[model samples]
Target: MVYPREELYPREVFDPRDVVDPREELDPRGMVDPPKVVDPCNAVDPRGAFDPRSVVDQPKVVDWYNAVDPREGVGSRDVVDPREVFDPRDVVDPREELDPHGKMKVVIGRLQVVFSRAMLFTLGLVFAHSLVDAAVLSILITHLTAEWNEYSLWKAAIVVNVQEGTLAVAHIVFILLSDVWTGPYKMLLCSAAISALGLSLFQVENVVSFYGPLVLVTLSQAGIVVTLRPFFDDQVMSAAGQSTAETQHWTSIVWWKCITLLAAASAAFGLSRINPFGTRSLVSAIIMGSALFWFLLGTKFYSFDEATGSPLRDAAHVMYIAAVTKRNVEYPRTPNQLFQNSSGHVKIPPHVSWLRCLDKAAVVMPQDQEKPGHICTVEQVLGAKSLLKMLPIWMTFLTFSTVSATGSTFFLEEAASIDEDFNFLTFIFWQRLSSFVVTFACGWALEELGRKMKVEQRMILVRMGMGMGCCVACCVAAWINARHWRLVDSMTVSRLVPQYVLLGVMEGLSIEGLDNFFITQVPELTVRYGPAFEECVLGIGKFLTAICIYILTLLWRWFGEDVYSSRLDKYYLMLVVLSSLNLIIYCLVACWYGDWRFPIPAEDDDIETANHNPVDEAVQEILLQHEKDSLPLLEQKAGQDTQTLRSRSFTRPSSPMVAHRRFYSMRS
Candidate 1:
């Protein structure tokens, strides 16, 4: 390996800054040939020198590991083969060297920070809303009779039920309107203002005035629930960052449920004790006002996406196009024969053959040739098809939701009869607590399990488990109700606690599971509005519960006269049988359900395709032409400046020849 005197280190073109001995030389027959030194002034490209013959030449070394120095003026004997000179890869595997466990620790630590921050801000809103809810639902019922002498228990129940029914309708309205209302914060602000006004109006002494405030409060509450739930879910998504979207989405939901639990606990355990209506109203108004203020403070930081047009309209269009095109065109055996939208964004229709009837929307009729984009895109058809597929599952859950509604009504009555000391608020507290603990725990457990299974399978399993819980809860309730009917005096709140706990377990899993399923399964454009849909489902459930209650009221003979005397055990038993049947049906449906065939492409891959796509190029050129047409005056005024700016903005060349030309041109 010893170098000869002449070849070790050549002095020609050698820089003083380089540390090499000029007297030493390298052997001519070493691993590589002697280095050729070129003058910086005479070089064709100063970036690096390469042999002209190297274009078609094989590499000098048999292996990359045995290659000599790539740099100039360092011969083979002076510089050892790179493989001989220490290789870090030889000693350290990157996965082991970098502390793989530390990466997980970092992610978990970041999640904790995001969770804490989101909880701190959102928990305040939760507290404020919970106060308003308790005041409106619980205190107002007793307050109208205790203070104003305006209502009987029957009247109060009727009024409350009416208010809730109105709210449910309003929730559905807002969910449908979400596509038109791009600014959720505007709704948030309006909800707060209306709620504050409603709370303040309650201070009035007149009985006739109550209805005005009641209507405003009910609408405001619905607006807040529809707007804020989705808004907060979006907020958590933002804080979570993109890498862990699924985990963060689930975590955010869990945190939100926990906050609701805290709110209920606050109301049931603390706010219910405040007997004075005016005082309670004032507190609610202040908290609501504070929530509004807090929301406004963070307005600049919030990132809101513009709403795409309504999914309902898209679904409608899909149906219309399919019907119109059905008779004119022959169905293509291969999906590629059908009209595929140039934009990869819209799901290709014919690919999903299961929904063959809907695929008619993708047929390009003569009318479509004359006017492109008038016909429905494949994406619209896919979205509509997905809705059709999920309908059975939604209906099953809708039936299950009836059990939840029973808790607030008959279940509350059962608890009250058991212990007068336990009261309405205490029952709400226990219900909230059970929901919080069970939901948060189950969500966390499922999240861990999700890593091992596909998301689709995990969601189904969670729902099935929830269905089992509901079945158990119904069985318990039926037994308790039977005991109450037979003895009439042995019921206790402590005895009803287990039922609440079980119901909580059922609801927690079902609600979270459903939310997760829809958030991912629904149209990508509507992902941000997922929580609004959840509210709609809940609203429908409550509405159905109202209907059920009304039907029960009609059958007075079997139900006795009042809460204590009513033979509600039969109703409990009925639900048990109904839910058992529903459970069986759900199992069959879950087993049958198939995932959406048109999986949305990843955002990064879509961007890359768009950059290179010929169709995208044409569209971009059209956009650029439009821009030029719109800015003619500006272009004329700053013609030279604009040209110079455009030229400067062109991506710089990376090659040596281009760099050299640019360098000389700049010097000139």
Candidate 2:
């Protein structure tokens, strides 16, 4: 099928970079007129059997032979089209030329890399926090201080639970950072520094003075995570970080697993007499150093699309809000002419729906082709009041955050129980080995797990699994401290090992899907309320757990010390009951979540919403009107640099429809 030179590579007005020699791309028609768009990710065959149009577009490469629709057999209900999920514009079949399996090899390797790098950084924080709690929990549970282990499991749960709010608290603070205009890197650095300091003190202290430092560390961590959504791909949403585009929930699961596996290995196979507390402190130091290094260096690649905070972008949104309320003074200052021309950034009028504006040459702005004032306004309700329209979202957010925080705190003690003999590297080694095997199993069996389940139902099952693990943790502790529990005759090392691993598995399930659920329900409140909401739920759980423990203690008191020592399993069984209640509540909440309804496009709701950008209009207005009053603070913040430095802006994509349409596509 040789063609004239004109047909193979034509000279045209289209940018050469966009051009792909049809011979190289999937030019199925040697006889067809002008060449077509290319697919980069999928490398399908060039023969007439495939349409190639629906495939992704990308840099042209020559070669052909491969099945493109391999996913058809695997995809059932709710299965997402990876093409649309990754990007709509880049729909070329990257697997067209290469063998089908070859691309998968590359894709898997890429996934491992992407997954690992992100997982390591996030899990490091979880490990850091859990290490501290493990030391505290271990010491208290073992009654090592000559002081009575008077606290009930609920009280222990509360102390640890309060800090779980850190994840959400970080988010709330990050929204404020949007107003203050701080970046994710800075937020993360601060979080790490504070966490390290807190852990260091824990290494040299008793429980009486632990709360102050712990609170500081929790605040910093929550602010960083909440504001800076940890997912790397969606890091570049806005300069002020008002509108979130990416979610960092997956990191929670990955970290939870890492922490649990590490802790379990330490507990099951650690030195017979090593101090879990000291080892945790040492590990915390190492993680802090790594955090500082990444926050400084790796941050260049990060952007604030909810994964990080971007202040300038928030300023632009403020301008949008001001115009809506007819306040001209609050508009984003028009870039000074000198910088404007140099930066190639002209102010767009406020009424413009960014989704409907696409600036081709520029990296940002991809809604419509219109410029500035030409963009049109969307008439749908899109403010705080609108959020109330869907009352169930907040309810679910609260319910899930509460349970997730409880479950994660339950894991904290489990993670801190690493083998005394394992050094940091060895601990990490065992963690990697266990994680690799377990993660593979989960991936391989996810389809089967989801077969008869909705996302909500599956998640409840996950929570119950975690609850069972907590029961396992209590039983394991009782077995290890059997003499005190009056079970010295039956206590054995082997009995504890399985319990440790069981808890790890449970942590994997409970921690992994939590953030994904929260982000799904309340994306709009992310900037101002994301962390606040998360922290509030976590705090409530922790506080309640503390109260429950007190109640448990009173109940145990009535029965006498002999009763507690002889019937420790009773306490273990009680945890099972409590977790069961939470798991049931989660499933019920799932029933009420009608994701199918939303004025915002489906794509906008994604964990990586390519274009879901909604500013907190109420919050933005308050900040703008008060900016004059806060001028001193702004001045200290270096004069509010909402200006762009280069010919670039990290904008949020706005196709919520596309995101939602296929959200339930990848169903079992």
Candidate 3:
């Protein structure tokens, strides 16, 4: 409901006379004198006293006594009599406070402005969605063995390992086919439907029915990650206008993740107590259903990026063109020497010098006279170059992915072998929540440091460092595992908190680093592709982990046959060495790394002035073209009064369209 000015300030309701009188007194001209005074309360008609709907709600109440007269002689009581004042809180409607514009606004104290109702609803759904995901990750295999007696622990490990491999494949397939998905709404609906069907079919008493649904479950989980996550990232980036908003954006994501983990942890614990009904999966299905409903309800309010066809197609085309245009060519003297035009041009970006061979794609050949853009635009070539550049950095994250998969798979298995005397509460408290606590605590400090440094790339580097630290911590935890193989009887799951906490920190920093880096660096046309590419990277990592596990499983003689008789600590020690080596490689890559052309805050002119790269110069040329092309077409002729359109054509191609046109132009 609309708030009324009078209701907000019942004492001094809006008065035309008061407004006029104050201005007249404050006016230095002194052109008028106070004629008379009329009590507005008595003069108002009973039927037309105040139309509350017509008034705007003022956030700040005006104290007329102090505000009306700036002169020191005017005391607090001079302009507004003490008797006329009333408590605004008494008359104000709290509903108006929540929604002044008659639209729902979700507020958690100060965060109301940034976190809209729809966003909060979406985040809630995310939390519930993650409950299902994490529970699957943390509890599914263990549940299969412990409660259902489907298989032995070692066999269960194999089943779980296979499931992760399946999950990675599912993610890769979804990403490749993401172009067909349309938008997040459809994906959410699809995920919910698949999850419901899978969970329902999971109850059936047959191996075919059970494992088949598990595959569907894996697909559904992929849907959630590929769809929901990008949508949220879009929202956060859209809303992050100021530094506070940026911090809040990351903070909200971390908080959502924490809440999701906590919910998942709770669901995992609840699995034991909920009896024969399979309530954990049931609740998960229910949450998925609820999330779908919420997503559908909020669809209208949700924002989507301008769909720029499939990134897969773009990448493929670039590769095809680069391959077709291959030549034993020398580098051009200058970038502009290759493709020079009024509207567009190609550039051999210096940053991409590591792969000088790819630069051949942008090399204009005499064959171009026969087929103009059959090769590709300079930008398209650069886009392809970007993908090549990303591969090395992507591989560095493989070790991290391996570490993460091990933590969830091996650690959960370790928890199962621990003392049965410890209640679920103890395990949940120690194993589940400690990571969140450390991440939440450390995430704030790290983010604050990033803000102080004012370099987002530095934060990315720091985040990777944290990931390396997690590797170290994992190594230590593994050493402890080697030393104390069966401490579960006394200390129980609580002793594993160190490893969990470290992994949690690792996830908070490294995974988020990957996400933020991509979002910030990737061009708008390929922005949607960033998340999918990330999924692909992590998928490869998971696949690598699966391979390692399978190899380890095959060589049971080396790593030991099972958890009880296993020298798992030695395996952990191996990972420690691998991680250390990986860190050294990553550091070297990081040292050699040059950042993509990132958008800087308008205030920071130093980066632009200090060191300009070839890509930046190319982008600047396009921006200048944009400025030139966008000149106003309608203007009054020099001596004529009437407006007339300019002679210039207004059909200039957009950035992506231009690139596409350039590609085909060469073919023609």
Pick the TM-score winner.
3
- The better candidate by lDDT, 1 or 2, is 1
TM-score of each: 0.67, 0.47, 0.68
In the range 543-594, model 2's lDDT, one tens digit per residue, is 5555654566677632223323324355445554555554556556545444
Candidate 2's C-alpha runs over 4 A off are: 1-106, 109-158, 161-171, 174-181, 203-212, 223-283, 290-489, 496-502, 519-536, 555-568, 578-587, 594-668
Kindly give the stretch of ten consecutive residues in candidate 2 with the minimal lDDT sum: 659-668
Runs in model 3 deviating more than 4 A are 1-113, 147-154, 233-255, 258-262, 268-272, 299-301, 305-308, 327-330, 340-347, 366-373, 421-441, 451-456, 486-491, 559-561, 594-668
Top-lDDT candidate index: 3
- Model 3 residue 192 distance off true place after TM-score fit, in angstroms: 1.3
Instruction: Report, for every candidate in turn, its global Cα lDDT versus the true structure.
Output: 0.55, 0.38, 0.56
Candidate 3 — what's its lDDT?
A: 0.56
The TM-score, computed over Cα atoms with residue i paired to residue i, of candidate 1 is: 0.67
For candidate 2, what is the lDDT? 0.38
Evaluation by TM-score, superior candidate among 2 and 3? 3
Off by over 4 Å in 1: 1-111, 115-123, 138-162, 176-178, 203-209, 237-243, 276-279, 306-312, 323-337, 341-356, 371-373, 418-421, 453-459, 555-561, 594-668
Sort the candidates on lDDT, descending order.
Answer: 3, 1, 2
Residue 283 C-alpha lDDT in model 1:
73
What ranking of all candidate models by TM-score puts the best one first? 3, 1, 2
List the RMSD of every prediction in angstroms: 15.6, 20.1, 16.7
